[model samples]
Target chain A: MSALLQVRGLSRHYGQRIGCEDVSFDLHPGELLCVVGESGSGKSTLLSTVAAQLAPSAGTVRYRQRDGEWLELGTLSEADRRRLAREEWGFVTQNPRDGLRLNVSAGANVAERLMALGMRNYSQLRGIARSWLERVEIDAARIDDAPTSFSGGMQQRLQIARTLVTQPRLVFMDEPTAGLDVSVQARILDLLRGLVNELGLAAVMVTHDLAVARLLAARTIVMQGGRVVETGLTDQILDDPQHPYTQLLVSSVLTT
Target chain B: MTPSYNFAFLDEDTKRMLRRALLKAVAIPGYQVPFGSREMPLPYGWGTGGIQVTAALLGRDDILKVIDQGADDTTNAVNIRRFFARVAGVETTEHTVDASLIQTRHRIPETPLREDQILVFQVPEPEPLRTLEPREAETRTLHALADYGLMHVKLYEDIAQYGHIATSYDYPVLVDDRFLTSPSPIPKFDNPKLDRSPALMLFGAGREKRLYAIPPYTKVESLAFDDHPFEIQRWEHRCELCGSAESYLDEVIVDDRGSRMFVCSDTDFCGDRRAEAQA
Candidate 1:
């Protein structure tokens, strides 16, 4: 398959501070890539810059539109960018509240993206939302409940459901399993794995957890100090210590 | 410094500026053109936008009418009419059909407007997406892009929760299939009249500092899901005074025993019907 996204020399800077610099990557259809780094690393900054949520100070992020045309994402008009974000891509923030509409019901959260894509059938919207909730391992009975009523794991699952309901070509997920309990995290990870494989979705996930990258991603990127330190197969990087940062990241994980 | 303002209370330069914006509004059909909205003698919410629009359009030959909640004698409407009379020295009429310019607060007149007339709406909040999205900057970007997903989701959520869109007043509409605009606080019943209108319709939001217009014969659609089409409110009771079943009615508390009566909200229309019945 042709490359879904192409990022070349992408960088984002906040004044004199470096957010992400000299980052280049290509994502194919149905491929899951993970960006792993420490707290101060530019993992999320790189993701946000590619997602167009944050403005980049330098370099270019090229996106292949659904119409077989590749365009520089940096130069797109605000309207075109918003439309592309709604139709072609999705962003899952780390905090579920940032990704989900807190006041609206769970069903509406999943249905909002469909509405943005111009789905006007009320019955169909509700039906798809209900199925997605079930797919996310959420009971359909709680569909009408607001996000406030849901637990942290349930809210995060709902956010995932909402993002994937659009069937976007690419999804940007920031630490999807970062805040959940171990058991809930395992369940969510399994559900996400099933959806990603079944839907043939291309995803760029950011997490500091090596285990998360091992379970979900095929390719992994290691970053330190706002730059890519290592890139390889997930198993290869996690099994062998290549770079000093990658060694520290792999060795720190306690294999019980 | 007590200085006399020009004709209709605005200076020629400001009027010219307003007229230029008004022309652009007509040209674009539903797009909100940003203008330097002037503060009127009235406060922000009391139809200041409508007053400014009327002041810009008023001339010696134009007959003006003002109504609040469809009543010419309502306190706010009466004040506006008195102010226009004192300042512009123009003739005022309560009859909807006779007036060349009608500035309304909430309800559109029952009388079908003529092609020669203009309807100026007193808009408190002009941006339809403001209720769904709180951020002004975000809403402006959405407007610029004609992205109305927030509104659709809000209405669709109403259906998912309540089985119908619960919005009765200030129902959102798409003007010329381009901009989603607020029809002020007018009930959804008046929304149908906005489509293919013979009269030129101008909307002014003084506090929000925006002005918009809908030219004659432009389409105005109420935002709704496909399975759940847009609908207006209906009542089982006919007008108690005019005995008309078709007119929009307002409920009035008649007694201390919790009694109420449904009467025509458009006072002039009700009065004319009553006069005709008596004759």
Candidate 2:
């Protein structure tokens, strides 16, 4: 399968603090790849750099456009990056608050990505928002409620709804279920698994949790101190970890 | 008294136009009413919208409070408060409970506001459909017809593409189930405050030439679908400074080595907490 996204030698740093360095990966069409690491291991940095939220210190992020051409994300101008971010790529932050505009209704949040993609009919927007909300397992009657009123897990689901509303080819999520309760996290992971399989969309998720990775990702890449230490099938890495960090992570989850 | 600028630093004509717009905003609850906006002494992207609204609403008896990111001592807030004190000759207070009218950019005060208070928002763009549609002429038609089909398609697309929606700021909302509006740029954490708020809420976009409002007791809904309704951000992390788990917080970089602290965004709230501790 042709890769939908290609990253080469991606590196980023804030002065002496190394955000991420010498990272490289490829994502195939309809693939779910989870980038797992510790808090300072540069997982979020890699995701942000690919999403074009932060400029990489060095390296290239190549996105396969609909026209069968690859566009270097770093080389694109700000306007182009914004356009791509809005129309072609979706990014969900670690914190649901960071990923959604809370003051707007649930419908508006879902509609915003579509609006960015140039959808304009209100009746159509409302209908689609309602359906998407139902698909995410939220009540349609609460469509107008502020995101602030929803629980942590619900907000993450809503954040997912807001990003996916645009129908972008690729989506990036950073620690999406980090702060949610376990039960809520399970529901979100289940929803994400169902959606990814149903839509056949390509996704890159950054997380510190191995269980989350196992739940939603088919492929897993482990990073330690800003370098990729392990890469393989999610089950393989989880069942028989290769890297010391990966083993530690798997053991830690099991112990707790 | 020596004079430095006109009444409230805004020319009389601008104030009059804002006053007219304010009246219209009050007349139609939760509707984004357009007005002839003028450039202010401050930059367009700053608090020109809230400054204009404050200029229009200022009276001898009115007590004004200006806050940015929910703090009165913030430089922008101080400058705005000074502007009013110098130009309009109105008293300025840091207390949310004391102020008759509060002009805010990016945040709502922590205290529960009374019905007598008025909250004016500084909006960069007033149209909720602008991001979805981009063209003003087309979005106006969408609002006029109460059409929101484009918004739904966007959400559906999110499910199809990312397995979720991917927006974080300036989220759109449905007002009174009739008009779709932007609730300024307050974090999703602040969205619940707009629902059935006792204090009247008004929005002004100086650059966009629009004004809007939500009357007390009016139904304001953030747009969402039934299955994936809207949600706000909550943190397991509490405010380090005020020890407040409920209040909105500002993430602060405390040291050069990257140590971080979370402080209450509302200065009065923090100060009150400090005072209580001392007592």
Candidate 3:
């Protein structure tokens, strides 16, 4: 199948400092890709640039609409961009507080996206939000409860539900399981994997952990210091370790 | 009066900036334009917005009028009037008809404003969705989308709970069918005057750093559901002092008992009516 998103020569710079440079990729439908890099590796910059959250300094990110036409992402109007983020694309932030609207109830956060999509009937919106909460393993009754009241793991799952309830065509997840307990991380990863497969979601997930990449992504790209250093099948990259940074990463995790 | 300050106590550059913002505000009709709010001689909520707007718009020949809750004798009104009389050396008036510029808090004049007059309101809050949605970022987006379902649900729930929409004052209105604006704290009675009036209406919230305008002859709708229409407050008693039944009445306690007497909230209106009665 043709790619759903085409990004070429993408770069973002912060004055004298480099954020990311020359990042190019094509993402297809029903594919899950993981971007693995450590702190300040430009993996996040690349993700945000491609997602059109942070504008690219020197390249293009084109999204192919469902009608089979390519539209330049950078040129979309503010209204159209918001609409796309609400209806077609979902972004899951690393910190749950950043991803979820903390002031509103867990139900409203889920229903808000539905509301942004033009659903007006209160009961129907609440019903769909409740079902999605249940699907995310949050108690249906806790739908009215604020995500702040949830445990860290539950908050992450609620964030997942808020993003996925829109049934977005693509999702950009920034460390979906970064700061949770090992037990919590496992459960969230399991929930995310199940949903992505069942819905045939296209996702670009950024994570520092090789194990997370192996667990979620069919293909993986390794970033180092504002550049993608390696790209290949997840198993081949994780098991063989081609780049010096990838070898060091695998060895450090193996040693620890 | 000693004129120690610049014209209207504002620098020419500041006035020019304010004038530009005012023009943008008039063009947009209800969208709030952010401006650099200056610290004035008065406190924040005590008509700073109205002061800034009046200062920017005041010309040497403009007759200024200031009123608080429809009373020119009130301390806030008296001080604001004294402020302009001293700094700008402009003539001040108590009569609503003669004044070219009226800076008000919580009331519009009983006299219908003319095409030459301008009304500036001191606004504590500029966003109508603010009470419903606390976040400024979210409210901006909501205004952009023209999606006010949150407000509808709140009002609808009020109807479901109380058998009526219980809000009495500072009622919300959709301005120019585009921006849902707060018509300041003016009671809903003054809302009708805002609709298709010949005079230009400007609103300023200094503490909030925002200003907006409703040009002459703009469509302003007080928000309401189809089944439950918008309604203004009315009192049973006529003005005991002026014997005018049409004016907005303020209830005054009598004899420290349950008995009460209603008086006209508009001091000028009541005074005019009493003079005409005596004649």
Against the native complex, each candidate's DockQ, computed on alpha carbons, is 0.84, 0.04, 0.09
Docking quality tier of model 3:
incorrect
Off by over 4 Å in 2: A1-256, B1-6, B11-14, B156-166
Model 2's alpha-carbon lDDT is: 0.82
User: DockQ winner among the candidates?
Assistant: 1
Best by the lDDT measure: 1
- Cα lDDT tens digits for candidate 1, B19-84: 999999999977888889987878889988888899899988999999999999989999999888
Pairs clashing within candidate 1:
none
Which predicted model would earn the best TM-score? Answer: 1
By DockQ, the candidates rank as 1, 3, 2
Q: Any idea what lDDT model 1 has?
A: 0.91
lDDT of 1 by residue, A59-135 (tens): 88888877889988899888888888898888888899999988789999999999887889989999999999999
Candidate 2 lDDT by residue in tens digits, A1-256: 7799999999999899888888888999899999998888988888888888899999999989989898988889766776787777888888888788775678778877776555545557778888999989999888877789998888889999888876778999888888888888888888888888887889999988888888888899999998899999999999999778888888888553
Q: Cα deviation in Å at residue A107, candidate 1?
A: 1.4
Report iRMS (Å) of candidate 3.
5.1
What are the TM values for chain B, all candidates?
0.97, 0.92, 0.98
lDDT for B18 (candidate 1): 90
